[model samples]
Structures are given as structure tokens and as C-alpha cells.
Target: MKKRLPLIFTSVLSLSVLLAGCGTTAKTGSTATPTTQATAAATTAATPAPKKDAEPFTVSLRHIQIGDAQKFRKAILDDVVKKTEGEIPGLKFELDGVEDQVNRFTKLPAEMAANNPPKIFDLFGGTGDALKFAKAGRLLDLTPIITELGIKDKFVNLSQFSLDGKVYGLPIGGSSEGFYYNVPMFEKYGIKPPTTWDELTAAAETLKKNGITPIAMGSKGAWVPNMLVNTLMGRYAGPDIVNQIPAGTKKWSDPEVVAALTTFQDWEKKGYFTKGELGLEYPDMLNQFVTGKAGMMFDGSWRSSVFKDPAQAKDLTNKVSYIALPGVANGKGDQTAINGNYSNGYGFSSSLKDNELKAVKAFIKNLYNEDMQVRGLLEDNLLPSMKLSDAAVGKVTDPIVKQVLESYKKAGSVFSHFDSTVPSDVYKETESQLQKLIAGKATPQEMADAIQKVQDAAIAKK
Candidate 1:
């Protein structure tokens, strides 16, 4: 997302006054009445005056292309804007329409550099593009403003938005990644959610023997397979080790990582994935799972909402259940250390006016207020980052939402999704390389070496 730069001259002028006052104050004698009064006056004058009943600036908004167009465009955005208006009095947001994911990724940074950038924009999860923008000084440091607004403590898992101890964004929602299985199919085949790696492989073999595709995967997007790979890494190497590789502490060629990749390749050979998955588009993979043509799918909690409506997922709704990705022996991570990442939130530009920053903060607070949080979960079927007072989830009729909420509450730790934590340029490389490893085009050692090369370059840049 692009941040709106604050009005720089005004802030600099105020800062200069404060600094000048500090430098000259001690030189003036306190015994002199004139000097004392002047010093006091200067100190008071140096303080930046707060806006008094100023008209709220209009914030032009753009969001990512939502999967559920009807709900997001028609319902969620309007509700948030309306609630914001109520909370911030005169604040207003003008929807500039949804930006396609590809366009948003490619065009938004340039747009932000232009004079007429949108006041707010939605950034995709896991691309690290937002962080890059922040590093370039395009994003506003919201930590101080967030603290002043008293919403800082409301954030759970602050680590999600923290890069080197500085917060560049707020996570508005979160979801977990795991295996989504067909309950009825499991019953019919006498299969159960796999509790161990061996059991998972056995189940996959059973499905293959019965001529049913064991896993429905969409490799066209490439990130889909990386999600599963991440899950496997978390289980086999544990969250700490897996996280270290990305952070430049651990080598990619660690034995645990090799074992996980080896297992992935073995599964591919055992016919665990959908035929022609490499050629299938993301939507087609989703369609296969929703239509019950596939026995299982590896996806996140967001998939629950996609499969909740019988009208949309006729064969999948009410039949789907999720479980933590199975574990291998010596897998030191707990089930709670599952694959997950924070939902996108707003980031401001450093050049925004104080009034504008205040307005943005107020708008955000209202958007995450108790009622909106409930509505986000219930009506829109989206998780809210705010901690809910009750798990009843009121209007969210989808059993899957309830299940997801339960799972989140019990989770021990959340790891950033594979693509989200990796640098934007290397994201596709990671995905493509992992695919090659799975296809037997590259050995696990070679895959590890390739990833190490990327990781080494990234760390050197840091």
C-alpha cells in the first residue's frame, strides 16, 4: 500500500522552533524577569498547536481486488467508511475502485511518487513490497501516532508488522494455513485427519489406490505450492529453524529442510497431487476442491469463507474440516506454530499533515471498533484483528468461521506466510525453484543451495 506523505514544511518549521528553543534557553539567566518570560513564551510558542475543529481531509481509497466482489465492494468498504464518518465526525473516504493485484503490485509505487497518489491503498500479503516502500522512506512511521491514539496495545502479535523493531503497518486480520479435507469423503474411505507424517502418507496412498486425487493444488500461481512447502518446513524444522533461514541465521541445506523437501518429492511420486496441477490455474484448482473432485486441499482459513456458501461451493460446504498440517518425527514445533500471516492494514505517508494523520488514526480506530469487528467476521466472513469479547461470532453463520476462530485462539505462534516474508523479487524464484525440486528437476541439496544463494544476497544487502 502507498502511504501519503505528510505536509513537510509545517512539521519542519515546528521542529526547528523546538530545537532552537532548547539550544538558547540555558544561556538566558533565570534571574532576569524579561529573559524568563521570553524563555517561557518561546517554549509555549514552540509547541505545535493542535487543530481545533478543523475540517477533516478527504482520503481517496483503493483496495486490492477482493475475491468476493459482491461482499467486499458492496458491503465491507461502505460499512467501514460509514463507521469512520461517525467516529471521526467530518472525515470522508472516496472509493477509487479496486486495483487488480498485478497492477497494484507494479503500479502503486510509482503512483505514490506522483503528486496525486491515493490517500490509502491495499497491499497484498507476503510480497514484502510494503517493507521495500517503507525502506525507501515512502511509508510513514505510524508507531508514535498509533501509541498516541491508544490502539497500539489492541494489536495482537505485533511482530507481524515489526521490521527491525519498527512498525510500518498494522495487521487488520489474520488466518491460519492447514489441510482442508472432505468430511464425507474421509468417512466414506475410512480416512481421518492425519496426525503424523506416516499417517498422512498412508492416507494419500489409500486415495491414490482408490483413484482419487489425494491433494488438490494450484501451482499456476506458484505460491500455492510454497504454502504447503512452508507448512512442511514448519513441521519438520520447527518454526524457529524455518524462520531463521529466512532471517539469514540458518542455512537452507539443514538436514531437516532436506528431509522435508525429500518428503514433498516422494509425495509427488506417490500421486498425491492433482493431475496436471502444474498446468491448472488457481481458479480451476479452487473449483476442483469446491466441486468435491479432490479429496483434500492445502489452504488457509480464508478458504473457509470461499467454501462456506452452498451456492458457491455446493459439494464442499458443510463437508469441509481443517486440521493442523501433519508432523514428522523430531518435528519440534507445536501444532499452534502453524503457517499464518497478518491481514493487510493501512500505512500512512510521512508527509501527511498532522490533521491528516489524526484523521487517519481516528478512521482506523472506528474501522476496528467493536461493532465493525463483529460485522467484519459475521457479515463479511472476514476475520478481525481485534480480540473479540465473545467467540459466538454473531451473524457469521458459517461453521467454518467459528472453527477458524477457535483454531486461532488456541494457536501458539504464527509464522509469516512463505511469499509474504521473502523479498518481492525472490518470491517467484522461491516458488519456481520449489516446484522444480518437487518435479525431480532439482535435488533437495540443489534447491537448498539455490535458496541459500538468494538468502545470502538478501542478507548482504541488509
Candidate 2:
């Protein structure tokens, strides 16, 4: 979800030292002490070192460094480049950064289609992006090195980035979604973090009576609201239920799915969210929650960095906590299985092979160690794909992020964001109709029917 697309450019910079000619000049008649040994040594001292016979290998990298992701790159990616300076002979990096996520999903594949993919590039870790590349034979199979680096055991949800029995990539960063609540507000209102449908309603009612907005949300982007709605769907249907839709075993019209949408509708009817939400921007919604105007905001784990900023949220030192949205009265989904996945990461291009692959592996090994894990968790609000040791986990300095990491560890399972792995048109339709559903312009049934039409069309074309 956080992966932003950028302009595509091939990273091909080949550098070799300019060979210097030996400074020794032979005279035809006059001999200058027969070119003394001191003169020869001086000539040698001025000569440049011989260039490597092997051409400089460029590991082309494409990533979007927006918001605190820039901090992560400076701390991790930039640091990797700095640390490996002269460490690996003939190794070079071309980190092509995109400022936003505009072309990453659509345009990246075109680069791959041309048979000139980056040696290592950013890939969203879902069936939609990473899996598509793997299925097309565009990505390098990391199976041999996955075990060699012990990355298999260190990471969670590696299967999402794997196909068949081979791994294709690794998500350096992971994400999850839940209600980010104001601790002091909850305590001041004598309210508790809810764990069931009725409790959540009661809490919302209590907050409403006190003139506090129960939830902070904006629908201008459509995605902000749908993310929460997806979380509700996960609560009603099982964690893996969405897979059935792609498999043609379930319809969006199924009662369980409809019930989830109905639940969201009920919440809207009850004044649980900020008024005029459809027009409000997502940043404004988060700002409201962070500044303590609302009881909570259903948002991604990526927001941890914002909350961690003292200038952004002065009230939130240790006053924010993350928890899953309450389970439904008769829900089938695993309550612990909230919305999450290894949403984005780096994958090797298929062209890197044999000895070249060795440098890639070494760089990755050096990249995902304990120091990067600390920065990812504490500074950048990212969860490391690798498991942290007890000592390293203890070093996580932010209480709110520590809480999120603990939730991540205790969760039963995770599902990819619904729109992420689905086809582009279907995702757009679902997001648009969801905005309408919350606006009362579309019924849950209408929305489901509309989505099913798109789904069926996609399936037929396939």
C-alpha cells in the first residue's frame, strides 16, 4: 500500500579508472642518469591503479521515498550504499527514486516487458505486483539464497512473495491496520478499548454524548474509508475468505459480506465519524485524531511515524495505542487476523545470475540486520520483515510502536488489502462504490452486485 510509483529509467552507469601512462620518457641521445630508480618510483606513484577486468556491475534500484520513508532510506538504504563503499569491488548502485506512487503499479511492468528490468527494484508484495512478475518469469527466484541467508525463518508472510516452492522477493517493510485511539481521551471518558460490536457502539455513543468525534475519517480519496470497511469485512468473513472470491467460490453478495457493509452503514447512521467526511482530506482526518479531537482513527501502521513526531502530535507521547476493530456478534473471521501483509519490497530482476547474484545476496544480508530493524521500528514506523531478537525487541523505544509490533506478533494471521491483489478495474470500482455506500447513495446489495459484475467479467476474460 505504501509503495509509490515513479518515472521509469534504466540504471546503467559504468565507471572504470582512466589508465595513466607511465611517466618514464626515454631520451634518444641524452640520458638522465639512465632513468634513475627514484624517477621510476615517482612515475609509479603518479600512475592510477589498474582497472578491474570485470565491468562494474550496476544493481539498479527503484523505490519511492516519500514522507518518513526518506528517513528510512537515509538511515538504511543510503547507509547501505555508504557502508559498502569500496567494500565490494566493482559493485555499484543506481537507486532511482520516485516521489509518489503514480506509475509503480501500471508502468513498472512495461519496463519488464521490454526485457530491460532493473537488476533490483521495488515490488509490492501481493498477487497483483510481485506474484505477477514472478509468474511472468521476470523476477529472480531467491530460493537458493533464501535458505542460505536464513531469511526464510527471519521473515513473516514470506509466502505472499513466493510462488510454488520458491521465493521471489522480501518485504523489508510490513504494515497492518487497526484503530489508533487516543489513550488520554479514552481514560478521560471512562471508556475502554472495545473488543466486541456492542462495546464499540456503546463507546461511540459515550464519546458522542461528550461532544467528541468518535472516529476521524475522510473519504475524498475513497481508500481511507475502504481500508476500514475491509477491516470490517475481515471481521465478518474469515481472514482468508476473500481468496474464495478469486476462486469463484464466493460472491460479494454473500450474506456475511453484506452484513459487514451493513455494519459500516449502521455505524455511519449512528454518527460515529466526523461530519462532512466525504469532503475532508485524509491528512486532515489523521491530523484530527492525532491532535485529540476524535477518539480514534482506523488507519494503517504507517501512521506511527506521524504520531511519533512531537511537533505533529504533542498529546501523543505514550498516549496512543493500536488495537484491532471489534469483532462482530456472530462473525466467522479470526478476530486477531486484521488487515495486513508484507505490502512492498525489493525483488531481483531475472537477469542477475551466478556470481552477480552473490553480490546481491551479500547486500541484502547486510541490509536487513539488527540496526535496520531498529530504525524501521522506532524512527520510520515500519515493521521489519525479519524477527527481532528479545534484546533487539527490547530496544524498540516508542511505546505506541512497541504495542503495534506486539499486536503483529500475536495476530493469528493477516490478509492482503482487498484492492491490492485484485485487478485494477475491479479495485477502482470497489473503492468508488464504497464511497457511495457510505454516502447512502448505494445499498450494500447494489454495491455487491456491481462488484460481482466486474469480477465475473474479469474471470470470463481470463
Candidate 3:
């Protein structure tokens, strides 16, 4: 049988402390003698004219939807609305926003700054987060309400959503990134997975010695290379280090960061990756690894589904082993941490009127109920944020997803994926420079300096 996560705090809605539906009493008059004109005036005052001031109530629930997971979630939301419409009468949900991140975030912030905004929306969990809105007093304080609903105990990564001891949002899924290696190549070469930077380099050397490509990576989009660079940064300066760089407390050129970048440059020179990697695209990188041309690939854990896709080669499914990139030797950072995040969950707006608040609150309560939580795990292969029931755990059948979960267990903490914590302009500049850094056209210092300049400018604008 497959395994499931155990749930806690499941029955709060059924509690007797819940608010009762309020009732109103109609007015009655005492018997009295009245003139015809007085009685007519009294009757006219008691009657109401057409309700001229009433308006349609609407709440926009915005989210960036992409890929299979978002598709599944949208379907779930549709079902939820179907089941909930009658329970929250007169409430209108407008699902709004572009599916891509660029449009999603840009539009969201502008709306937030203006008079109109999505009343509740799914949010990213890192630096470019709902917390910024929360800090600006634009988001609702969900702390007391979440506590009442016992939602705080439902998620494992609430720390990511929390600010100044209060949570601003809840996550739909937990995100993790790590290495997925070809087990066949490792065993054939008598090479074990590395646990430190030196050991990892040694393993790469061994693979090169045997005419095997060490790491399968594509840098065409730039984001690909940052994964390795970010992981190296975590190992060198610890998880919180890069976070400071964006806030102007630290520079990208700090020696430790330089060292991390230098190491990244060194890896390229060592020929651990494919030739002209900056020209390679993502699919080619996956193809290289899955087809056994390379010994390992670095990517998102969500790729597990693709690895197991029936359309892909049979070799990938049976031969891959997911593992964390080894830590830096004698580094100041937490050796066991991973580059990860939680994303896609509701964030309430401060602008909601009383009726809107009540309706949205009820929706949030239903959103994380056991049924939806289980469906996310079983149908989506998501690292669910909600606590699960034993029955739900038993429904998870993917071994690779299970492995990814166990690997995350080794992390003492999770750092943001580099892009999530940096300004889009800064992130773009840094990612673009990574291609140059990888191709030996740019030195680590140059890359770091360029990144710092962009970040500094973005911060100044803020």
C-alpha cells in the first residue's frame, strides 16, 4: 500500500462555537385610535420603495496558472464553486489574471496600489510575496482567523508565509529543487553520491575520466544555471545570505559569494557539463540525461512526473536517483539545506467589506478541508501544504515523489529559488550574466558586480 500524511485539527468547522445565523424581529404596534390621515402616513412609512442603492457584490480571486498543477487546481476550484455557491449566496467570484508570472505579478501590484484589486489571490511565498502587501497594510490579518480555524497547524512551511510573527497567506504546495542522477552510471563507475564540494568535484572528475558527461545542464534561459549557483551560495553563506543582498545589507561580490561564483566558473572550465551549454535549451538537457548521455541533471522535483512519463525512454524511470547537491566543505552555511519554496495560495485583501470578508472566510475554510488536500496530493503529485489523513497518504503511489519528499526531510531549512527573492530586472540580469560566466566570457567578480549594480538600482527604486 502507498503511504499518506497524517492530519491534525480537522473538525473545527463542526464545533459549537461557530457563529449562528442571525434572525431579525419585525416591529409591532400597540392598539390605538387614529385619524384616517395618521393611519395612511404610518402605512406609507412602514413600506419600502425599490432598493435603489444595492450593488452586485464581487470578490476577485487572482492566481497565476501554468502547467498541469495549475490546471488541476483550477478544476478543483471549479468543483468547489459548484459545491459552495448555495452556501454563500449573492457572492460572486471573478477568477482573474494572466497565467504567466510577468503579467500576473505586474498587474497584481498595480491593482494593489490603485483603488481596485483582487480581493483574494494566490501568492508566491518568497520576497516578491503577499507579505510585502501585508507590510504595506494592504492585506488582511489572517492570524486570528487562521488560528480559529486551526489552519496554522495544517501547513509545514507556514514560516515562509509569516512575517513579524503573523502569517499573511497559506500555500497550496511545497516546492523543492535537487539533483536527479543516473544510478546506472554511478554504480558502473563505483562512484557514490557526494556529500561535500570536494567530493562532488571528485565525482565529476571520475565521470570525466570515464568519458561520461558529469552534470546535464542547459543555460539558454539563464534560470537553469542559477539553480547550481544558488545552491552553492546556500552552501557557502547559508540560506539567509542571498536574501540580504536584495535588501542592500550584502553585496553579491562579498568574498564568500565570489567564491561560490568562482567555483561555478571552475565547474564550467572542468568540462562537467555539455559543450556550448549556454546555447542548449531545457528539453535538450533533460533528453541528454534521460537518454544516458549524461550522468546527472539538476532541476525541479516536479520533473519527477516527466521522468516517469510513458512517452519518455524506459531507462530514465528505472535508473534515476534524486539527491541533494553536496554541501561545501567546512562552510558557514547549513550543510543540509535546500533551495525551495511554497507557492500558490490565497491571500485576502484589506479592502474587503464585511460581507465579502465573511464569504471569503467561509471559502478559505472549505479550501483546505481534507477532501481537497487529499486530491492535491493524489491527483497532482504535489508536496502538499496541508496536513493529510492516513487514507490520503495511502493513495500516493509514486516512488520518485516519495524520494523527493525524503530528500527535503534532510533540509534543516529551505532557501528561496533565486528568482523568487530578487527583483525581476535584477533576476534577469543575474541570470543572463550566468551564461557569460559559464562560457568563460565573464569572470566571477564581473558577474557579481553586474548583479549587485542591477540589484542596487532596483532597491533604490523601491
Candidate 4:
């Protein structure tokens, strides 16, 4: 959802295998053995006796797993919190849940600027977020903690969170951006899942003509529209364009990139997205789609679990399906490349006291492991960010998740969202330009030129 940098793996092979078949959907009741247990005896020989009664301390943990849709992820976090607290002498986690867009675009950046972020918080990787903070010495280098946890090699890609060979954060899960459509709505209209650009537009027209919003969208956060825009850009400009732009080898104002923006703007002019989408929030988009107000929605694969949860999805339970955006005719890039990202996750503040460090260590130990990774897949529909055992991947009864894996398998390659590849200033510029474009205040050429100007300055600064 946010931007990131070149992750550890140059290719998507690691995640491709993970998506092919991995992890269980079964809920686990196991409590993690204290990760520090092995070193306890060695530590006891050199350390002073601990006090029987320790002063209570609270570690602030800012997270984005808020709202009904995130309940499952929150439950997993609650379990880890419980286990971590049990192992710490007098530690308590002050969990603060905020909306994803606000946490990523507003609150977290302000906190990072003030050098007073919560002890642990949600983070995005790339030049704009984790890497930027890491360069400024605001984010803790998690290299040693991951190593001590014996999970340094477990993650599929850490490059997004790595700076100069030091790891800064760990992705919670892998995700791909695509369309999540209403199955019954498609059937009611006799429209099949669109796999070609013409078919996709035809389906939209069919739904729109029938008085249904063709696409469920919330533009209050530019990141929402940016998702579709990024995929389209990948189609027109080629998957390598994003990487080339940051290196000063390619320009954002390229004809193909502008064409992508133009295509998104065309959808806006056609009134394909929900009315007053600019006034709605991310959750509202999901609400509209789930209630049959819209025929389709472009979103991340992480959302697959929502359709399975009755409380969250309501009547939409077992009624939703997913599809990758159809390939554009005469597209320049790999038409089958899908948007995949392992860029969003938790990061710790660089400044921490002894007890806070211990809390951080315990948090990492309890959270980033095979068990929790599988739990994320099973309970939340999140693809595993860490490696699972050969026996871990089992029968996945959730059709939505199975479809997500199938979409990945069908893709010719995985292309990252541009936000993760560009400079933070350039990324913020794209967000601003996109909102303006959506509001009819800017043209596709204007948007591309504006973004390129910022990119030029950002590159000069380097």
C-alpha cells in the first residue's frame, strides 16, 4: 500500500515458490517458548540477581490493524503481545490502532520527524518511509535482533528494509495488487472475469449502464487510486520503468507513463468509480463493494480474508472473487506482470532503553517465525513473508486465497509498486498530483510533468 525499495532478492523466485504452495490455514494454540531461554543460564552466571518486584513499564506499539477487516490480524498480534508480556518481567504494550493511510502518510512521518515514534510501529519500506528514516537514524537497525532470533535468513526479501547491508525492518507478509470482484454480481450480469483490456472496459460499461458503480473506490487517500495507476503504468511503460526513473535513466513524463495516467483519468471521466469517492475512506470502499453497491474493487491480496469473515463481509461471505488487471493492448512491458509487494511491516525506534530493547527483542522473537507466518496466512489471508517448512503448505480451503495464489502463478513476472522505488519527495508528489488529477484539476501530462520535476530535484539532492 505504501512505497518500498529494492528488496533483498532481485527476482521474485523466493515468493513465487511461497505462493505456489506454503503455510497452513489451521489456527494454532501454541505459546512461543521464550526466545531468550537458551541464553538465560549463561546470563545468570554474569548478571546480578533480579529484583522480585520490578517496576511496570509500558512499550508503545502503534499498529494499522484496526477496524472490522483487520480483526484477524489484530488477534494474531494480541497473541504475540500476550506471549511477549508473559516473558518480560513487567512489560506492557500500549497498543494504538490507527487507519492505514493515516498511519503511513500522516502520523508516522510526523513522529519520525520528531524523533519520538512509538517504541514499535507500522512501517513501509522504500525511499519514502523505512529507508528514509533509517538514513536519518530514526529507525532501529534490526539486523542483530533478527540474527539473534535466528531468522535472519527466513524472510523472502529484506532489501526494502535494508540500508548498506543493515536490515531495518521485516515485512509482515507478501501481497499483490489486483481486482476483487463480486461473483454473484458478475453472474447476475452474465459477465465473466475480464482478462483482456477490452473485456475489462466492457464489463465496467455493462455494470455502469445497469446503474451500479463499476468500481468501488475511495480517493480520500491518494494511495487508493495510486494502486490502479501503478499497475497501469507497469503495463504501458514496462516493469523496468520504475527502477529506471530513480536512476535518472528514465523520466516520469515519458509518453507511456502519461498514457497510463490518462487511462486512469479516462475511468474518472466515465464515472466508473463510486460517486463522491473523493469523500470516502478506504474502509468505505470495501463497504460499498461488500454491500453490492459496486461490481468490483481494485485492492491488495491481503483483503482475501474479509470475504470469509461473516462479521466483516456480512452477505458477501463466499461471494467474492479476485482477478489481476487485464493486459493492455500493445502494452510495452510484460503484460502478465502483476504488482507484488513485501514492503509493509513493523519497525522500531532507534532510541530505546534497556527494558524497551528487551521488549523489542521479545516482540521480534515471538512474532517473526514459521508459526506466526503460517498463522498470518491461515487466519488473515496474508501470504507468508518468511520461509515455511516443506510440510507447512497444506490444503487451503479458502477459495479467495487459492485464487490469489493462482493469479500469482499466472503472472509472467512480479513488478513492484512505484511508491517503493521512487524517492519520498517524488512519491509524495505523485500522491498530490493524483488527487488533483482525480478532481479534474490536472491533466495526465500535467501530473507526469509535476512528478518528474520533483523527481529531478530529489535526484539532484543525491
Best by TM-score: 4
Task: Residues 1-462, candidate 3: write the lDDT tens digits.
Answer: 123222222243233123222422233553332333445776899999876743557777776655443565567777776555556767777877465445445777787678466777767655566666777787787888888888768776776567898888788776677788888788899888776667777888898999889899888867777878888888887788868888788788898889889888887888998877878977788888888878888887756666555456456665677778777766666888887767557778878788798777787777767788777665555677877767777787777778777777778977876666776678778877888888777999999999898888888987
lDDT of 4 by residue, 165-273 (tens): 9999889999998999999889999998898898999999999999999999998988888999999999999888878899999899999999999999999999999
Q: Candidate 4: lDDT of 55?
A: 78
Each prediction's TM-score against the native? Answer: 0.77, 0.80, 0.72, 0.87
Please identify which of the two predictions, 1 or 4, would achieve the higher lDDT against the true structure.
4
Q: Whose TM-score is higher: candidate 3's or candidate 4's? A: 4
List, residue by residue over 272-365, the lDDT tens digit for candidate 1: 8887788886668778787767888888676676665667678666788877775577776675576666746665565676666766776666
Which residue pairs clash in candidate 4? Answer: 3-419, 3-420, 4-125, 4-126, 4-420, 5-126, 7-159, 7-160, 8-159, 23-393
lDDT of 2: 0.76
The list of candidate 3 runs beyond 4 A from truth reads: 1-59, 68-78, 90-100, 113-116, 164-166, 184-199, 202-213, 243-250, 274-294, 311-315, 353-359, 387-397, 412-414, 418-429, 439-441, 454-462
* Candidate 4, lDDT over the whole model: 0.89
**By lDDT, highest first, what's the ranking?**
4, 2, 3, 1
Model 4 spans > 4 angstroms off: 1-51
Worst 10 residues of 4 by lDDT: 30-39
lDDT of 1 at 65: 38
TM-score for predicted model 1 compared with the true structure: 0.77
